[model samples]
Target: MESSLKIGSAQLGPISLAESRYDVVKRLLALLYKAHSFGVKFIVFPELALTTFFPRYWMTNQVDVDRYFETKMPNEVTQPLFDAAKKLGIGFYLGFAELSEEDNRIRRFNTSILVGPDGKIIGKYRKIHLPGHSEKRDDVPFQHLEKRYFEVGNLGFGTWPVFGTRVGMAICNDRRWPETYRVMALRGARVVVLGFNTPTENINHDEPLHLRMFHHRLVMQAAAYQNGMWIVATAKAGYEDGFHLHGGSCIISPTGEIVSQSTTEDDEVIVYDCNLKLGDYILNSVFNFKKHRRIEHYGPITSQTGVDDLIDVSSKL
Candidate 1:
């Protein structure tokens, strides 16, 4: 028996600083309905889907930054999206800024959630690999202050058994790291859905514009093949309030092939009927962790964050 499911990447165009949450949710609803029309059973929306990528600007007032983070999911402003998805029998993955109260402290996180067809949140993953700086930088046109706004994700990489197979979730920068996919794959994830709001320019260093898009695809493609899991990546693209985010939203198969991609850097929906069993060949043969992995030799991956003093091997040679 073939286990298959229809999935989609619901990409959004620019959202200005003034767009209300009401209007943003409306746009999301439109895309959701569009995906539903294509017989998509599950859809992935882009990171920071609600508002403009607010981390680009520097703000001293805590209240100003807090405005962009959602105090609760499916709050009054976003309830319509939930209601409509339930009515349409569609499950979805959504990314946003989360304002949470935990252990008597207010903490914010770059977050995403997996909603089941019944419109209930089945799983959640907070973003762990936050990029950019914590301080204000006046040298660049925009700041990448994700570190200033969000705490490192407290939840571990997790996979949920749903949609006839296990599925996982990641957000933005997390997709760039290999560990994100590997951890999920080790936990039995066959398909990983992620969303990103990637700026076209690199604020940290000088790099070609083309490489930004290239690196985006390269990392995800490599992760998919190495882990033998399908990767569905959606982008919040185009110029938002004059800042550009390149969009190359795509769906990659377990073989590292880009099966479907969005052509335009705008609001677009791309769908594919995915065979969940496609990764079995790779996993059972090349990536059988239980049979092939040597955990004793892989300690540095978790033990060390940066390069240590170089050992002098010339003597041995």
Candidate 2:
């Protein structure tokens, strides 16, 4: 018998920075209800689902930055979401800004959590690929100061066995890197969840606006096909605080075909009945990493090179 899992990609519109946690939770609960109705075993929410993308602005004051971070996962505001999921017996993957204290030191992380069907926290993945700069730049229209606000993720890529399938997660910028999916695939992840808040326009580039959506799907589709895993990518889309975010959330199969996708930049849910056995088929064939990979030749390409290595200094000399 082939094993299968029903997963949902809950694509949400732009969350206003002024919106309270109560309002966010209400929206999330609605999505949960929809996922439950569709018999989805797991739902993946966008990065920073509870709050607006706050890293766009450069905040000098610590107090201002703290407003965007969550002190606890199931605090007063988020408890209702937990309760509803528990009642419905539905598992979910949620992305948020986490604020925690370790050894009397406060640490902040761009994090995602995988909750079991019984509402128990199963796995936590802090985003390792922190994009943008740490300091404020005057030339740029807006700042992407994620590096300044959050610490580098200490938790390595890990997969958990749940709903009879191995699941893994990554957030925002993590999806752009091939290593992110490969790490999870190496751990036997049949399904991978991702959440993103990508801007439609590039502030530093001269590229076309329409290319963002194409690039988004391209990277995700390639990753899924290469890793032989089902990918559920949800996005936080629409305009918020003068920035327009591109939203084209999708569910991709092991064969790299988009199974389901959201059409508009609104609150939408894309569900797919993912047959986990497809992973086995792909891995055994085209994506057979063990049988096909040539690691010895690839190692030299990844090695660090000196500045002179790129220049024909010998010819000049």
Candidate 3:
């Protein structure tokens, strides 16, 4: 018999830019109730779960930009979520744009947090591998201004012991990279939770609309299989702010098999009974990182690049 951990992946649909914080919180509370009814111990929400994907528009006003960012985790608006989680005795992973003020200096980041069953924050991860352009470009079909509004994540990836499993987290674009999962796996993460807001159509590229879903599952599956860990990837799908997001939240086993997945581009939950011990079985046999990895031959990844050679000649105006 598999020693399973009851997990829930909540895939949120469209969140309009004009929606109020109160409305978002209500929806989140509803999902919490649903997860609790389903007997889920841990629920994973999508990236920027509280608001629309705001990076699609460029904003110069500080007040306007700060409206979309959360200054504190359990602030006035989100306190209900914490209260609900505690009431239900359920842990959850939530992602949002974080805004902090320290020493009168403002810092912004795309961040995610792992909250315990008691509503205490257990772990936090800021997105390090930020994608998209920093400046506004009128030529592109849509904007991806994540780099403009938020700073690169300073906190490196790390894992924590939770729910009888070593768990880790990554946000949106971080899931596309191998290092995000590998670093956490190296720390003995048996499960990795990731959230994304990926568009169904890449207006900047010629790839098929369905390919985004494929890549989403492929990366997580490979990472789980290669690192001997389970991967729970959730997404905010459907059209929001004139862009269509791909919807295919899923749970992948350590062997890379997708155990459970969301069926629609709506607010829905998919549950999985994940066996933490399966990671041990794979690590001891197939993917024993300490016994099989060849690190000495991969030094170029850390080698410094020449400043002049790194510049794009076509980028010069």
**Candidate maximizing lDDT:** 1
Query: Per-residue lDDT tens digits of candidate 1, residues 1-317?
Result: 24899999999999999999899999999999999999999999999999999999999999999999999998999999999999999999999999999999999999999999999999999999999999988888889999999999999999998788899999988888999999999999999999999998888788887898889999999999989999999999999989999999999999999999999988999999999989989999998888999999787788768677444559887
Q: Model 1 — which ten-residue stretch has the worst lDDT?
A: 304-313
- For each candidate, the alpha-carbon lDDT, in order, equals 0.93, 0.89, 0.88
The TM-scores, one per candidate, come to 0.97, 0.93, 0.93
lDDT of 2 by residue, 65-139 (tens): 999899888789988888888999989999999999987999999999999988889999999999888988999
Candidate 3 local lDDT, 88-119, one digit each (tens): 88999999999988559999999999999999
Q: Looking at model 2, how many pairs of residues clash?
A: 0
Which candidate number would show the highest TM-score if scored against the true structure? 1
Sort order, lDDT high to low: 1, 2, 3
| Model 2: how far residue 165 lies from native, Å | 0.8
How many residue pairs clash in each candidate at the backbone level?
0, 0, 0
Candidate 3 pairs with clashing backbones = none
Off by over 4 Å in 1: 309-317
Off by over 4 Å in 3: 102-104, 304-317
